[model samples]
Target: MYDNYAKVIVKGSPITKSNFKLFNVNGRAILPMNSGKYHDRYAIYEEEIAFNARSQNPSKVLDEALIAVLKVYYKSEKRHPDTNNITKSIFDGIEKSGLIINDAQIRRLIIEEFYDKENPRFELELFGESSFSMDYSIKPREILEEKITYNPPSNKKKALNDRMNISAIKPKISDNICEVCGKGTCKENLISANKGKTLICRTCFKKLF
Candidate 1:
């Protein structure tokens, strides 16, 4: 059933894994988060796991509903909507719902899905190595605070200075390497404007064209 949804998303148009694209993590399936940050905006697809209204009819009704929702998604995103008998109405829920994703993948998907730079301007920090800054942009603030704590008074001032220092600068996204080739470039090198993770440089990018 779920495969059906993936099928719709993959087969709706002339696009496929090679040409078709969807915002996804390097090693994960499913689009990360298109729900946006708005409180009320959301996807209307419904994937029902259990039902009591009659099995056969329910599945058919669900298929129709899912198809209708996918139609809306395809039109808005200009990409195909993947739906199947097993596809849920909405992938994630509120609070923790609506596109369950980690910080690294979320940032990667964000740059891939939204960043409007004509030329890909930046990349996300995927690897946290010694002597380098942590992926502060996508890394949750709560986690950071927990790891580094300062005493009050003099230490407090030192902490503020350090924290401000990190926030003041633009992030270097050379952290997230390309899963395909394992060699990642700085943010200025990526090209995600088209769609999906089908990333490539200008030279390689033209070859596809």
Candidate 2:
């Protein structure tokens, strides 16, 4: 029942995101960077996948939760990349291509691995969840605009009273009011002035100093 779907095929040896080398810095072991080979391969793979995804000509990026089915083909069966790592690279490429807002939008993912002697590639299929009805008329940009332009109702009086109550409950050095501006001051912000005889807020203290 998933009518909304898009397919992308990236031709090349699929790369995984988990390949990294460990190094010791200042007597502490750290594995902070990916291997040079992985970095270079991933860069090219991501670019190719983005191009393929854009070529699909999807009406708009799917905003709702999605289901991804990934088929990873390797040149040899002796070495196989981690399924999760492959999925990560694909999701990142899809996001970079603007096929979706973010990879977190994918709620379900399915992956399969195979060996191809001549042709090694990644085949990806994305679909809206069967339970939800996807509206092709609403673009992801429009959805973002709706969210950004939305303004929630605010009660200024209630907010002011809440702040006043919070300030009242806090410990104070003096009267909890700034001497110079007569604004509310907390204990942490109050500074002693005139040989501990008067207290002033940090702003007034800075001005005097």
TM-score of each: 0.18, 0.51
The lDDT of model 1 is 0.31
Q: How far is 162's C-alpha from truth in model 1 (Å)?
A: 3.3
lDDT of 1 by residue, 1-209 (tens): 33222111211111122212244456553432354432112222212111211232233211111211222122223323332311232222111221223222221111122222233211111211222232324544644443534344675889888888987775555664544455666656656644656555554556657
Give the per-residue lDDT digits (tens) of candidate 2, residues 81-146: 766778877887788888888999888776778879799998888888855443424345534443
List residue ranges in candidate 1 displaced over 4 A. 1-160, 167-175, 201-209
- Every candidate's lDDT: 0.31, 0.73
Clashes of each: 20, 0
